[model samples]
Target: MASRPRPPPPAEEQVGQSLSLGEFQNVQSLSLSAARMILHAMINHRQKGSKDGSIAMPETETLNKTLDYLELFARFKDQETTQSVENILGNYDELDTFEKSQLASLCCVEVDEAKTLIPSLANKISDADLKDLLDQIIAKRQFMDS
Candidate 1:
C-alpha cells in the first residue's frame, strides 16, 4: 500500500514562535559567517583563474545575501521544496567544499554556546534534511567545543 503523505511543515510563524530572539540572532550570525566564507572563497578562486565559472556576489550587503541563503535553507526543511533546494545547492558549485568537521571548527563558537544550541534546534525542526543539516552543525559545534 502507498504510505501517507506528511502534513505540511509548520508555518514560519509557528517555527518562529518556538525560538527566542537570541536563537534567531545566533542563526543569522552563523549563516552570515558561512556565506562570507563562501563568497571569500569565490573571490580567491577567481583571483586564482580557475575555469569552473564565477559566482557573482550581488551588489548587496553580506548580511542580506546571508539572510537570503538562510531563507532558502529553511525551505529545504519543507517537504515540498526539499528536492529543489538540494538540487540548487548541489548544482551551485562555486564555493570550495569543506568537510563538516572542518567547517565546524572554523565556525569559532564557544563550547558552551555550541552545546546550548542543539536541543533547542532539534525540538523545533521536523524535516529530515534540516535535521541532518543540524546534525552536521552540531558535530561542528562539538568539534569547536573541544
Candidate 2:
C-alpha cells in the first residue's frame, strides 16, 4: 500500500470577488479578486447597458470629486482592507444608489475590529448626521422592501 500526501488548503485569501472596504468583516482571507468583484457588483453593476448599450464616461470633474470622496472616506475608516475605498468606489460608480449605499455600508462599518474601515465614520459621525442617514436609509429600505 502506498501513502498519499494531503493537499494543502487554499490561502486565507481570495474567497469571493465581492468584498469591499466597508463590507470586510472578520475576514479570514482577503482575496483581491473577491474585493474587486464585490465593489464591481455594488457600484458598477448598473453601468452595464443593454446588449447594444453605450458606455458613458463621466466628466473629469465628477470623476475626480468622486475619487476624492472615496479616498477621504477610506482614510476616515479604521479597518484593514484588501483594497482602497477610492479604488473600489472610483471603479464602481456606475452602480445604482441602492447598490452604492449597500457597498458603502459594507466597506465602512462602525463595529469594532472589522476587517475594513472608513475613517471619521457617521456612527462616529455626528448624531444629527446619523439621524438623517438612518431616517433616509430606513425610508429607502421601506421603499425597497415594499
Candidate 3:
C-alpha cells in the first residue's frame, strides 16, 4: 500500500536559524554578490549619472612622478640601460619599503664605483668638490637610514 505523506513539522520544531555547510556556502556567495553590488554602486556614484556608462580612470600623480623619474634615468643612460631600468621600475608601485631600501643599497655600489672612477671622469670636477660630493653621499645615506 502507498504510505501517507508526512505532516509538515510545526514552526517551532522546524530548522533553527543556524547555518549548515550548504547554507554557509550560500551565505558566502551572497556576501560576494553584495560586495560586487557595493562596488557597482561606487562606480556608478563616481560616474555621476552619465548615460554612456564609461568610468574614468582616477588621477595618479604619484605614478606619473615615478614614471618621470624612470624616464630621467633612461635619458642619462644607453639604450640597453634604459630598457633594464624600465623593467626594474615598471612595477615600482608594487614594491614594499624593504625592496626600495634594497634598491638603494644596490645603487650605493654604483656610487662607490663612481667615486673610484672620478679622477678619470675627464677631470671636470675639482678635488675639493669631489670630496664634498663624497661627503654628501655619505650624509645622505645616513640620513635615509635614520
By lDDT, rank the candidates, best first: 1, 2, 3
What clash pairs does model 1 have? none
TM agreement with the true structure for every prediction: 0.24, 0.24, 0.24
Poorly placed runs, candidate 1 (over 4 Å) = 1-30, 50-136
Candidate 2: stretches off by over 4 Å: 1-103, 106-119, 122-124
Residue 38, candidate 3: Cα error in Å is: 32
lDDT for residue 57 in candidate 2, whole number 0-100: 44
Count backbone overlaps in model 1: 0
* Per-residue lDDT of model 3, residues 1-146, tens digit only: 49998977543421122212332332312112222334445555766745556666563686456445544432212333323433443344433223222232323334345435322322334445434444444444454446
> lDDT per residue, candidate 1, 27-133, as tens digits?
32323334445555566666555445555444458656765665454312232233333333343243112222222333324433332443233333344544454
Worst 10 residues of 2 by lDDT: 111-120
Q: In model 3, which regions exceed 4 Å deviation? A: 1-112, 115-120
Score candidate 2 by lDDT: 0.39
Give the per-residue Cα lDDT of candidate 3 at 32.
20
Candidate 2 lDDT for residue 123: 30
lDDT (CA) for every model shown? 0.39, 0.39, 0.38
- Rank candidates, TM-score, best first: 1, 3, 2
